[model samples]
Target: MYRIGELAQRHGVNNDTLRFYEKHGLLQPSARQENGYRAYSDADDRRLAFILRAKSVGFSLSEIAELLSIEVDKANRVCSDVKELVDDKLVKVSQKIIELERFRQSLQILSDGCCGGPHSAEHCTILQALESFEENDPR
Candidate 1:
């Protein structure tokens, strides 16, 4: 049996991380020692590894909980169930990438409009653009 610290150290996570996982029902100790320390079995170690791996791939705690539930009852789950979750995440990620691209384009426009001159800002294109408002701006 491994102590909590040992397990956390092996996993490169803080002690509180382990406790948080336990509290969130994502993981648990196999037993508690006589001295009141948590003892983790190999199965617990494997479970922790799974949790970390899921997190590395952008799964939120709640999503990871869903995955863990499915994992615990794999016999009743089809592969499409897991694929659908990934597909949803992919859509969200793709939307974020598009938003970021638009932001980059806007910044580029503002940057290209400016000469970056050392002169005063009285006639700076960037500043003027910032202060100018167009119709139908909605605010």
Candidate 2:
């Protein structure tokens, strides 16, 4: 068994992270000492490692919770259970990349339109383009 600080140190995470994990049901201490300190077992270490791994792969807390739920089910295989979630996340990430690239193109257009120096605000092409887009955007 290990104290909360010890466990956090061993895992290279903050004490608050351990507490937050406990509060959010991502992790649980195995027991409490007489002095009211939390004591963690090796199982807690493994769980924390799993949480970290999931986080590194871009899983949100809610998604991690779902994954943990799947992990506890004896009949569910990990690969099949996790594949759909990962696929969905990948789609979302791809969409974000496309949106970001579009945004970059728009910014480039604005940058190319603007010839910066001694220009009045009313004569700024960038400002004019922004106002035009704002008024014309249906979405």
- Candidate 1 per-residue lDDT, tens place, 1-139, comes to 8999999999999999999999999999999999999999999999999999999989899989999989999999999999998899889989999999998998999999999989999999987887774543677
Q: How do all models score by TM-score? A: 0.81, 0.82
Provide the global lDDT of candidate 1 against the true structure: 0.93
Worst 10 residues of 2 by lDDT: 72-81
Model 2, residue 70: distance off in Å is 2.0
User: Once superposed on the true structure, which residue ranges of model 1 sit more than 4 Å away at CA?
Assistant: 115-139
Report how far residue 109 has shifted in candidate 1, in Å. 2.5
- Model 2 global lDDT (CA atoms, 0 to 1): 0.90
> How high is the lDDT of residue 17 in model 2?
97
